[model samples]
Target: MSDSSVSLRPGSTIGILGGGQLGRMLALAGAKLGLKSHIYCPDPQSPAFDVTPFKTVAAYDDEAALRKFAAQVDVVTYEFENVPAATAEILSSLKPLRPGANALAISQDRLAEKGFLASKNIPVAPYRAVHLLEDLKAAVAELGLPAVLKTTRLGYDGKGQRVLRQPGDAEAAFAELKPHPLVLEGFVPFEKEISVVVARGVDGSVRAFDPAENVHRHHILFTSTVPADIAPGIAKHAAMLAKVIVVALDYVGVLGVEFFVLGGERPSLVVNEIAPRVHNSGHWTEAVCLTDQFEQHMRAVAGWPLGDPRRYADVVMQNLIGDEVEVVPGGIDGDTQPHLYGKAEARPGRKMGHINRIVRSE
Candidate 1:
């Protein structure tokens, strides 16, 4: 925000505002290019802190800490979309926040993201905003039963959302869900879900990775497979859709654009949602592609030349959830790469690590 014209050179420090797995990976990727990273996070046990010695354990709203962080780093970026708008503003005022505040604003709220995409003539599921019980009832009447009611803000990984199958389910869901504003979306009977990870540079250059088919268990992403059986034309179109959204936002850095495919061999697509940072679905790129999403993101944010995103293998990336962490040690596989996040507690539903298994060199 403060300096879009600024380009960081090697040895520049990039400040990252989240200390999850994504932040940890970003730091590692930056180090490969002679770039240093400073991580700022509230959690003392943040996994990212394990990799980078430069860290500030402070609340995001601590403007004093944020300013001090900005003074040390050349630019700022975040690993997650739920970062507070005020926090983004504080950082942006002092240094350029890659992907900018506009991208964060749209992605943090479901209603805003859907509306922004729809404005560009992109296909999204029919949705309506719900502010009250009566609003939810009216939305159900209009959009019909079997719709999804989700909180407008801070919802991710299947949290803060519910399905209204019966007429009486709406009230229960509304009462259970906190925060007044919500969104009700018509359910699409899609055959498959896919995602394209795209990167936009400060110079207005854009490139996209191949689309990957996604499968979920308990609403958490379980696996992502490259060379999704969708037709070649569909894959091209998915990337084009991602370009439209990224260009419209004037966003810099990496974005994860998800989609829903209907029909069989001849498929029609709908834009599901967009993540303004590196995504779980694109994890396969780390093992298969010469220029993975993590490095691509670093290149974009630091104003370096974007790396080629061509993949060299047919790969399936799988997440190790909770107790599944133990399975990796007893592994037998071909070209399997294990990436474990250094977290001590493997709580249920928590993402402990992931694997990128190369099926064959392509």
Candidate 2:
């Protein structure tokens, strides 16, 4: 790791891995801070390239291109968690990869992440690893029916997941999935879902934004509402949990931690997953907070002090998925701010844009 004292000033360049919407937003935020962004992605039509001045269209394993890209940037960060370990290693050897490879490594595998969290005494859903048909059957027996069977790696947006609602469903589900490395999680009968977006500075200081209550449609994030209708104590606990994770990873940059809110006489939170980069759930921070999550991530990766994450107003972020993007330009009111990712084709289940509406102050 580079010395924290060796901060990248405003004119420095940040190299971002993965040229998706998250990268696009980060590039826009960096530009506001007078920091240039160089995007690296295999896709020639990556939307992030539209905003960044410097871009390298190459595969993640292109070491020659990776080295060349690293030499030009002062620091490195990623927009997604699935960044290959080798890619992160090569980049960190040349330029500082803030949040480090460990963060990505842990978050990439479901088993490892759950183990790490459990070791840290952080609550998570009951899970068991599965490798074969017998293992799947045993895991089903232990976790019970109505459990989730998910692949250990590279799964997102409802992919690589199967719900086993009955004992007989396990084998068929496993057959359908053919997941070599899998994890079975006992379902959490939670009333709500929430996420905390937290930033950890190079100095190990952590700052977390308030929890945002999340709503999902077809297993994809539908909306995120800030000033989530939860007890203040429970919100604080969730933020604290995120801070614990950041500190444990020795992370520098922003991370999103998703939680299941169990509503009862005693409100509690259980971690669902850890996103090792700027998250979809945090888009509301763009319109509601003075220092948005994107800028906060840029600041942290550049070795700057952590920014204030407190929101002064209540806001709701609604994603414009697929055809919904077409109506955003005309359907939104004056209070709503529309952000469109410069994606050319709006395929089904693709996130094309989002609109944030400030509802009121806390």
Candidate 3:
């Protein structure tokens, strides 16, 4: 792919799937570049709809709506991984889809994702595929106890997964989950979780942000600190691994690679998963870097040169999940950069918004 192949003129419309906060941010970024955004989501009150110029409040399977949206947009991109494969195919036939539907299809399933990673020589946790009782038993024996059983599809924020510490727990967990294609992965006992957010342009140009160490609570992201406490060489390796995956996928847009960092003299990093869109952990880049992940994504998909991923300051991004919004008034007193997604109601464990705080080092 060449730079000249994709172009976003001043009035070109960018179609976004899944109108969440990521879509909202991507829409904002497109506006800055003199492009318009038309958000497509089933939710009537999606936050992204507030900012975008056009919105289609129809189901993903609504072929008529999908065709109409495809006709109006110059290029299409998605905010979430769960966009149906059929929906992506329909949009691709009508207009160019950024990051491509192949990335979505692979990342949406755990088994396929891990297989692709292993095929590319990327190191992921030892895993086995499970579809039945015998398969679970075999996976338990191979991957061993203290392994996690995750649904092959639609699992996120710790949902659709359970950890088994011993042998007997598998059947009950399987019964509770009840007949979903699953993957058993040996538990990775590591120091911290870290992620690399990289953007690959249509021209094959790649740029990656500094690795950020992530902390999870209730299997959801809690905090992310940039310039993670890892050796520079190891951090560089993490970024390189991310770039490799992006290029191998022929990806054009922002993608995130999560890793388990085993702290020690060697400090090995193991691939956890890949997010084929701007990640929540990279939110700090909005305030602390030369280019935010959202803007970089917009630029890349729009066929612009990848921006510099240089960080201007050390930063920490804390997610405002659920009732945490109450603390916003008190939290804003400091030098914190607060970003509240326009979610009307905040339920437990739901990601309401996030705030980024920059700490300068003398």
Candidate 4:
């Protein structure tokens, strides 16, 4: 179908699953273009509901609720990957689910994600599956120490993952990740982490934003700097890698691909993970790029042609976690774009909001 033909009109409603900050930003972006959002999440105080026009507070498996929700929207998209595979399948049968259910299934499991990358000939760290203690031992022996042991599913922001620096660390690591399928990956001694946020329209055209160098504090992303300090060729390669994956999955909407850049005369970019929706790293685009990732995502899923993913300025985005929000003196300034997710409580390490500062080059 043509891009203009599929573009959602001003009065159309878009359905979103998982009412987190990403969903909130997405709804806001949609509203700017005259579209309305209907948020579907179990949390009564979901942050996205603050911006959306309609909301359905119910479990993913609530068939009656899902049916009613599906009847109200034109298209459906999810904000988080943990939104049960069956949930996507059920909703897809009722309404068009952007990005498709296969994308969620592949990204939900560490093993499945690795396999998909390998299948596409994308470079990833060496990894092995571990279903038992003996399997863990075998994987360690094969992949070696100083690796990471992570659960196969439902892990995020450094949770459900452990780093094993030596042989002695395996037993404790395994014990900690008990009662779950796990995977061991040989750690790559890399110079830095970078991510590419790309989008694919329903027509199969794809576009990618500039890669951003990422810094993690306590395993959670703290800052993202765009126009990543890397060779021009490597930056192009990163965008190519994201495009390859998006086309392979026949994915529609925003997708983020994290990479580890191993420093050398010629840096090697290795895939770290894939996020099926708009990512935190891409938040810099809000102030620096011609098109923000959230807006690009809305356009793609709405079947519009992807916008020019060009960077307009140098930018740095820092996430405000928990108590950090309290320290903002008189709140943020005009130039500093502050986005707060209307969450009721601020607990330690929770992503409360993010601020983007744009720097004009001389």
C-alpha lDDT of all candidate models, in order: 0.93, 0.91, 0.90, 0.89
Mind sharing the TM-score for model 1? 0.98
Rank candidates by lDDT, best first.
1, 2, 3, 4
Candidate 1, superposed: residue stretches over 4 Å from native: 264-266
**lDDT tens digits, residue span 200-228, model 1:** 99889999999999999999999999999
Candidate 3, residues 159-198, lDDT tens digits: the string is: 8888998899999998877347888899787999899999
Q: Top model by lDDT, which number?
A: 1
Badly placed stretches (over 4 Å) of model 2 are 1-5
Q: Write the per-residue lDDT of candidate 2 for residues 8-39, one digit (tens) a residue.
A: 98899999998999999999999998999999
Model 1 lDDT, residue 61, Cα: 91
The candidate with the higher TM-score, 1 or 3, is 1
List runs of model 4 lying over 4 Å from the truth: 1-7, 327-331
Candidate 4 lowest-lDDT run of ten: 1-10
Better of 1 and 4 by TM-score: 1
Residue 92 alpha-carbon offset, candidate 4, angstroms: 0.5
